[model samples]
Target: MKNRIRDLRTAKGMTQEDLAEIIGVSRQTINAIEKEKFDPSLPTAFKMAQLFELPIEQIFLFEI
Candidate 1:
């Protein structure tokens, strides 16, 4: 999957740690997600969507 995590974070002026704290994950987890090295669980995805006020599809996309 690919994501707009980094762009969104920058747009919101939020650090990885800041997002992690709001979503109850570790900064490394946020980093991994931004790098597309990790995929969040459903609830985590929902929380992230809620935080960004975007639909999940806007943030995450299937590569193929």
Candidate 2:
């Protein structure tokens, strides 16, 4: 999964820890997501989309 999490977070003036706290995840999880090392769960993805005010597709780009 290629995501715009870091870009969005920074654009919103949020740090990874701040975003994790807001979305009920860990900072490490946010880091992993930003690094594209792990894919988030459906619920987590929903939380991120809601927090970022973007559609899931906009946050996480699926490449085939």
The best candidate in terms of TM-score: 2
lDDT of 2 by residue, 3-56 (tens): 999999999999998999999989999999999999999999999999989999
Candidate 2, residue 5: how far the Cα is off, in Å:
0.2
* Candidate 1 C-alpha lDDT tens digits along 6-42: 9998899999989999999999999999999999999
Q: Which stretches of candidate 1 lie over 4 Å from their true place?
A: none
The C-alpha local distance difference test score for the whole of candidate 2 amounts to: 0.96
Q: Output the number of the lDDT-best candidate.
A: 2
Question: Each model's TM-score?
Answer: 0.95, 0.97
lDDT score for residue 50 of model 2: 94
- Every candidate's CA RMSD: 0.7, 0.5
